[model samples]
Target: MTKFYSLGDSESEQKRLLRQIDLYGDTRGVAFGAANRVVELGCGAGANLWIARQLSEGSYVGVDVRQGQIDAARRRTRDLGIGNAEFQLADAAETGLKAGDFDALFCRCVLIHQPDPRPIVTEAQRLLRPGGRGVFIEPDGPNHYMAPGKEALMKVFHARTHYAYGDGRGSPGAARNLYPLLVNAGFKDVTLTPHVIVATGDDADCCRAFLRHWMEIIAPVADALVAEGLITSRELKQALREAETVKPDLFICHTMWQADATR
Candidate 1:
């Protein structure tokens, strides 16, 4: 139950996530199209609600582990006058929702952070009714890049992919295992689409926004990483110090797998 996003509920972080929706959100998960009821796991800050609406005009139950995220989602739903939404504070793997209550299940950029994603996959299976669909989007952790040498960020990614953090499972690169995991969890009609995040110096806004994302993840875990000898305190300070002034020779991209399946 690691809130692996690690970026706490700050106004700046909220704004960054809102911008992330615009920059990276796509209709690739529209496999839930027209479903009558949906469940969105790890639905942080309700930014994805708009996209959720496009996929289905039905009621949605947004689930997350952090109370702050739940509050943020509720606040956004209220502010936007969105009527058919509800937010719950719960882990994705143990949602406490009734089984077979949803027509579709959705999560994006969620599973890779888990040390063992099997429980979440099984929970997704349990949440949906027969014939229900799910769209799970996860990144290729091993392929993520930030150019002009983002030393600290690169080290962080390397450590994650090398299984230095998890229970020797290396869940950061779990996107590659989605097919087998979902299949073994009793889901059918499994399909996967290749998704990519590509931002270059020309894409200034997205580049900076992505930089903010790196800082968000980096700053929170700097001390732990330093204590573990994975990163130095000086390197952590330098990374945070240069956050705003980081060179835009920045080229960022990562491969991702978007799995669409049925229960």
Candidate 2:
């Protein structure tokens, strides 16, 4: 299993995960209304479930492999006094959920972590009723980059980061492969929608948050990268410092592909 670089139950990490969930949760069109049963796989901290609750009065179930995450999610639900949302501890690929039990299955940034996303796709397919929807959001690894001028800096940063974490052993390019995976899983009307975040001067807060998220992800592996001579400590610090400094000319684009399909 590929370890999650941002793995932790710290308040800061939880806050970051919630911020990320808020950032990417509703970009795709997956309609949720009254009584619509929705399940989110690898639902970290139940942030997406919180979003789903606002959109519908439906019951929401969030599953995660980590008990700490599940506990935090449950606490969040309770703290918010949200009665319709629940969290469970389970593997994304084999959730032990009832087949055809859900009206909609949603996942975000989950597939990229899996070595073989097909199993989770298959599970989603199995869980949804006929004509039910599956909304998956994932990163297109290779396309995550900064524009020219800062290209050299980004290149080294990405190279070291990817070397330590990018390839999930199964499908590093899970976002690009979502359509085929859905089709092969017998889903219909699989539509791919691209959600790109171009962080420039106007998006200063977003840009800072994005870079801080990257900093958190890279921190755990910094020592290893330095030891391997993949990236110097100074170079890593420079990249982080640059990420913090968002200029008008700064162009950083993070693209996430959202694929919606019908079972």
Name the top TM-score candidate: 2
Q: Report the lDDT tens digits of candidate 1 across residue range 1-263.
A: 76344466777767777776666655434645554789999898888887456544678899988887788888888888888888889999999999999988888877876777889999999999999989898877777787676766677656535433365443766788899989999999999988787888787777778777766655555677778777777876766655555465777886778889999
Candidate 1, residue 153: CA error in Å? 3.9
- Estimate, for each residue in 1-263, the C-alpha lDDT of model 2 and write its tens digit: 33553345666777778877556544435557677888999888777755556545578889998888898899888888788887778988889889999988889877877767788889899999998988898877567777545543575556654664455644667888888889998999999889876667667787677767766656666667768777777776677667667776667777889888999
How high is each candidate's TM-score?
A: 0.85, 0.89
Poorest stretch of ten by lDDT in candidate 1: 161-170
lDDT agreement of model 2 with the native:
0.75
Candidate 2: stretches off by over 4 Å: 1-9, 24-30, 55-57, 147-153, 164-170
Q: List the residue pairs that clash in candidate 1.
A: none
